[model samples]
Target: MAELTGRIALVTGGGRGIGRSVALSLASAGADVAVTARSPKELDETAAAIRALGRRAEAIVCDVSERTQVDAMVARVKTALGDPLILVNNAGIAASAKLTDTTDEMWDRMLRVNASGAFYCTRAVLPLMLAAKWGRIVNMASVAGRAGAPYIAAYTASKHALLGLTRAVAAEVASRGITVNAVCPGYVDTEMTDASAANIVKRTGRTEEDARKILEGFSPQGRLMTAPEVAAMTTYLCSDVARGINGQGIVLDGGALQS
Candidate 1:
């Protein structure tokens, strides 16, 4: 039998990039999946792909930063496919600016979406996991969470808060059969990275290709990490085999920031 044959998973930001990949990966592992994001079109595509894998799937439109929306999304998932046994907090946004240039609005927005969004979603689904005595929670964090970087203070701070939440919750639930962990990938090949590169081009007058190369150069492997690679790690963490792995931030940056 498949590892997660009877489980249900909820993946936020499931419309595209790593979230979409993780949702599909969980479905492939035999779990029914419900995906949430703001984009109906992308969520529909992701849901369609999961259904093609023969697993039950639901696509929900949600803005995770709002507690009401998060609660509603989880309730909808429960009604559609039972309580989610696995939760992937992948909904996030990023922007780069010098610390002095960063606005109050930008800082607030960063924490609202990247950190608070995960907290709200996790809080909503945690009760079901605790009651069942089994759960896997994976937060899609970033390398910035671990170390400092230039021009991304707000993004970095939000991710650090997320990691803090991961450790605290993992410790809280360690004895309760629930594991919480984070995946911190550096410079992923996603639309988010593309936007970053575009921003670089605009600010530095560098060609798009050169801007991309600059981002890729951050990883020792000289390439951006693929969504499937992150998804594979997330799926493994959600499996029975990974029950012992908890409260960890597994880095995937090709040997960068080893500590």
Candidate 2:
């Protein structure tokens, strides 16, 4: 067991991808985790994985974009399990689109889920964290946030906003024993990247293999980061060893974004 023994953690978007990996990583470190996602079925899988690690899991169904639902989610988490000492605001959405082609719905959806959702979840959790005098918040950002991608205008803006929020909150809560940070990953081997790569293949009329190579070229390592690799950083940030690591946007881009 790692240093997170007995700690309670809540991970939004815990059903799949990096979020699911982060949840399991926390459990492996001896934390009791609450996994939240829009689908109960998916959340159940994450919970089952946690249970397999001999850790308790609170499976929660939540759509972080809705404020009312977010409030209810916080209440429910506290009610069913306990106050979460660590929060991973990993819920997000991205669209590959030009600014001119972006619709109001697309832009708003990106912002609501990627940026505003983090705000709401953080707001809901901060009071309790302050009262208890300890907390760790990790927001998932992307390489698009740091550099201008050709498309994905809305997604880029939203992730940039999320990174800003992460820094601001970390500064505000520094004296409260709370560390707020953002993890910005470059091309990750997740569903989102799969979709992006597929789109590139279609647009360029190139083979999927070639398109994947082009995407992978964005990383200096010429490869995608694994969810478990990113999860390791997240779990570390929540541990006692990372008390001084605050307000930083930790990029997992395989040297794509030097920071």
Candidate 3:
């Protein structure tokens, strides 16, 4: 039997990057999936991909940073696929800037989208999971959450706050059949990384490949991590075999942080 047979999952930031990959992974594992993001077109594409995998799918246009929008999106999911058994808080944004140059708006945007967005989605889904007594919550954090990075203080701070949120909620729900965890990846090969590379090119006149290699250098493998690699870890966390794993932050940086 498929590992996730009969499960219902909701993935925010599902329009692209890691969220889209995780949504497809969950659907392929037999979970009816609901994908939410701000882009209608991208959401449709992800939903169609999920449906092609033979699982029921829905696409919701949502900005997770907004509480009302999140609440509404959850309500819609409940109506379409019943309460989601798995929630992947994948909606986030990243900005690169030195601490001294970081504007208040930049800091707020990072915290609001990357940290508070996860919190809102988790809050909206908790009731459904509690009622059912079995749930999986995966927060899409970053390596910056665990360690500081140069010139991206705002982004790093937001991820740190996300990890704190993950740990605290995991503790609160430990006794329940719910597991809350974070998946931290370093320099994933996604649109976000491409944008970062472009920014580097504009700033330093380096070739795109060189800028990309700079990011990939963070991983011991000397390559940027793939979206599917991150998705596999996420799907595992939602499976029955991972029931024992709770309140943990699993790093997928190809041994970058050997602690």
Candidate 4:
């Protein structure tokens, strides 16, 4: 039996990487999926993949950092797939800079996209969850959120804020049958990580392989984390078996940061 049978799930950034993996996994588990992203083309591709899995799917164009867009996206999802019982706040952006070199614009953008975006999406979906008396919210956080990284202060701070939001909202809805949690992965092999590697190469004048090695070495296992690995964790969190795991930040970093 599928764990998510009859569930409706909404995944932000569902166009690619971890978001795409999570959306497909949920559909495989029998949940109808609604996908949102800034790119309509990517959203359509993800929607098509979900439908290919024998599930209903809808694509919505949205930038989760914008409150109005978030609201409209949620409304569309509710109308198309019914109220989303599972929400994965998977949209985020990251950049690296020394604390003294981080620009005001970079700081603001990180917080706006990574933290505020999750806040807007969560706020938009909570009402429906409360009314139904059941919901699961999983924020895509990072190991940087748990531990400080020297060059990416803004990204780290935003992820930390996301974790804080997850805990606060989880507590508020604990009695309402809604669970809010976060998945913190370290150095996942995604487009974001690829960009980070390229950035490192540009900054340090190192070979791309060398820059990638730095990331892979972050995990004790000496390998980069895969999107499917993170998606699996997110998928489990949305299931009945994970009801007791609320208000937590589950780490999937190959035991990199033992907190």
Candidate 5:
């Protein structure tokens, strides 16, 4: 935990869910945190939690999909804290639609927010990390990226592309003491999943328990993973002991689809 003491970290989409948990974890471990989200309220709440842990926190309003805002966010974080050495590319979007029903707007939005967004933020922070010669980047991916799911073509494809980007970047900077990796989680009890589950129950006319079990069928544990559980894996990946683990996509599936 003390390994991150004095480090500057940036977490995108830190308003809630796994992103929020990751931000708190970093702050608890002694890192200064910069939290970015479209919603200022969520960002403020995250910042408050970080400060409660006795660490510096910056609540930056940023839409990672927007290059201008992302750039400004980087500058603000650096100005307020320092050059971020740890980055959690946790911002992502999800839309559920079949292949034929998936509109171009949905596809574009997913690519922009889930894929391009990660690229923009990471690119913005690279200079400082390169100068320091040490960094940790953890991208939030999903099991859908590894195992395709129905009614979420855009989200699945975006995550698939994100994993590719994560691997490619990890290779390019592996020699420079920078680690870029992805953590792919299975179904988590987040608002997004709750909505998806509700839709499943409505569409299939099944009991809530049955609908949940259907989702659980993807995991051997037959349950959804927790946000803190996913955060733990990410926190460990950012640790000094995990310096050699690069270009790896660690699955947080609870044995989902057991590859």
Candidate 6:
């Protein structure tokens, strides 16, 4: 039997990028999946892809930053796919700006989606996991969570907060058959990174290739990591074999940010 044949997974930001990859990966591993994002079309596409893999799927339109939406999303997941024993908190936004230019709105937005969104979803699902005495939670963090970099102070701080949440929740549930962890990846080859590169081109007057190369250079691998690579790691963490691995941030930046 497949490792997660009886599991139900909920992936936030599952419309595209890493979230979509992780959702599909879990489905491939035999978990019925529920995908949530603000974009209904994208969410529907992702859900259809999961169904094509022969797993049950649900597409939920939700803005994770809002507590009401998060609560409703979880309710819908439970009604549709049973309790989500596996939760991938992958919804997030990224922006780069000098400290002086980072507005209060930007800071609040980062924290709300990247950190509090995870909190609300986790809280909503904890009861089910505790009742079952088995759960897996993977937070899609970044290298910024471990170390600070210039020009992304707000984003960095929000990620750090996420890591803090991961570790604390993991500790709280260590003896309860639930695991909470974070996957800290460097620049991923996604639309988000493309936007970052575009921003660089607009701000620094560099060619798009040069802007992308700058991001790729952050890792020793000299390339942007693929979404599947991150998805593979996330899928493993949600499996039974990974039960012992809890409360840790697994970094996948090709030898960068060693910690």
The per-model lDDT (C-alpha) reads 0.96, 0.91, 0.93, 0.93, 0.91, 0.95
lDDT per residue for candidate 5 within 110-189, as digits (tens), equals: 99999999999999998888999999999999987787877889999999999999999999999999999999999897
Candidate 2 clashing pairs, residues 3+ apart or interchain: 97-152
TM-scores for all predictions? 0.98, 0.97, 0.98, 0.98, 0.97, 0.98
Stronger candidate by lDDT (2 vs 3): 3
User: What number of clashing residue pairs does each candidate have, in the order they appear?
Assistant: 0, 1, 0, 0, 0, 0
Estimate the TM-score for candidate 4. 0.98
Candidate 4 off by > 4 Å: none
Query: What lDDT tens digits, residue by residue, belong to model 2 across residues 69-185?
Result: 989888888887789889999998877877799999999999999999999999999999999999999999987778887778899999999999998999999999999988888
Best by lDDT: 1
Better of 2 and 4 by lDDT: 4
- lDDT tens per residue, model 1, 1-259: 2289999999999999999999999999999999999999999999999999999999999999999999999999999999998999999999999999999999999999999999999999999999999999999999999999999999999999999999999999999999999999998999999999999999999999999999999999999999999999999999999999999999999988797
Candidate 1 lDDT trough over 10 residues, lowest sum: 1-10
Sequence-dependent TM-score of model 3: 0.98
Candidate 1 clash figure, as a count: 0
- By lDDT, the better pick of 1 and 5 is 1
- Alpha-carbon RMSD, each predicted model: 1.0, 1.0, 1.1, 1.0, 1.1, 1.0
lDDT of 6 by residue, 1-259 (tens): 2289989999999999999999999999999999999999999999999999999999999988999999999999999999999999999999999999999999999999999999999999999999999999999999999999999999999999999999999999999999999999999999999999999999999999999999899999999999999999999999989999999999999998888
| Residue 190's lDDT in candidate 6 | 97
Ranking by lDDT: 1, 6, 4, 3, 5, 2
After superposition of all CA atoms, the RMSD between model 1 and the true structure is 1.0
Give candidate 1's error at residue 54 in angstroms: 0.4
In candidate 1, the residue pairs with backbone N, CA or C atoms under 3 Å apart (3 or more residues apart, or in different chains) clash, namely none
For 45-161, candidate 4 gives per-residue lDDT tens digits of 999999999999999999888999999999999899899989999999988888999999999999999999999999998998999999999999998779897888999999999
Q: Report the CA-based lDDT of candidate 2 relative to the real structure.
A: 0.91
